[model samples]
Target: MAVERFPVEASHIMMFARSVGDPNPIYHDEDYAKGAEPGGIIAPPTFVQASSQYDPDAALRPKPGQPWFGSGREPSGTPRGGGGGGGGTGLHAEQHFEYHRHLHPGDVLSAKTRPGKSWEREGRRAGKLKFSETITEYFDQNGELVITARSVGVQTERVVEQA
Candidate 1:
């Protein structure tokens, strides 16, 4: 995932925190955060994931003229093809985050991702499984590394049709 610019705003911090069921004042209350160690409002631990909204080509976002299966202004039908439950798109197996520093409001962040390692395994019930890792590093306006996110995606052998 590569995001050119992701501006961290105070309101966005509060909303993301609330959406994740976090009630911490450090995420919303500026006055309360002023007395804290960071001295200002900080984003939630997983708030960086919200950067996907800024990524125009994010995998989860449907392409133009493509049909999506969720609610929208107009009704659409779901695509049907894969039957083994993997749906061919793979599954999110794991997520890990490393925070170099607390993200404060007014920080313009950017992210760049690189592929990690790939491995395969045999699943007792699910059959063949392939796992791949993606490491994304988020940098601040000053080009300082602010956070690192490691994600693992797993796909079943059934994801591909046997021909």
Candidate 2:
């Protein structure tokens, strides 16, 4: 999936930094950043994760009554995990990012997301666990690669009946 171009603004960077509990002057204070090595306000490392919000059809977004991948199925006539059968909710197993260059204000970035890998393994307690990975590469308006991020999701199959 292709995320719509996201315009990096100083305010967005500041807000994102604040949300992540980062008080770095380089991310929130343009004046301070200008005197730093990057020479302008730069976004934090995990800021690329917010690109999902710019995607209209982002799979991770909530959709009432729809079971998202790794989110277990709800048995018929049973409230979600109320009884009958149940499974573990989606779990983010891992995340990684490789920054090739600094992301600064005024840079319009776009992301290309694709499935990276999938596999399954036997689990002593869960019966079986499936793992899926996704990768998103962010590019600048000039078509320069800036960052690459990988995320893994895990779902475990039920090995015992719901109590």
Evaluated against the true structure, the overall lDDT of model 1 is 0.87
TM-score of 1: 0.83
Compute the lDDT of residue 147 as modeled in candidate 1. Answer: 100
lDDT of 2 at 83: 30
lDDT of 2: 0.81
Error of 2 at 15 (Å): 1.5
Kindly give the stretch of ten consecutive residues in candidate 2 with the minimal lDDT sum.
75-84
* Number of the top lDDT candidate: 1
Per-residue lDDT of candidate 2, residues 1-163 (tens digit): 5786988888888999999999999998878888999998899999888887788777767667776544355433333452324555556779999999989989999998899999988867666678899999999999999999999987766643344
| Inter-residue clash pairs, candidate 2 | none
Stretch of 10 with least lDDT, candidate 1:
74-83
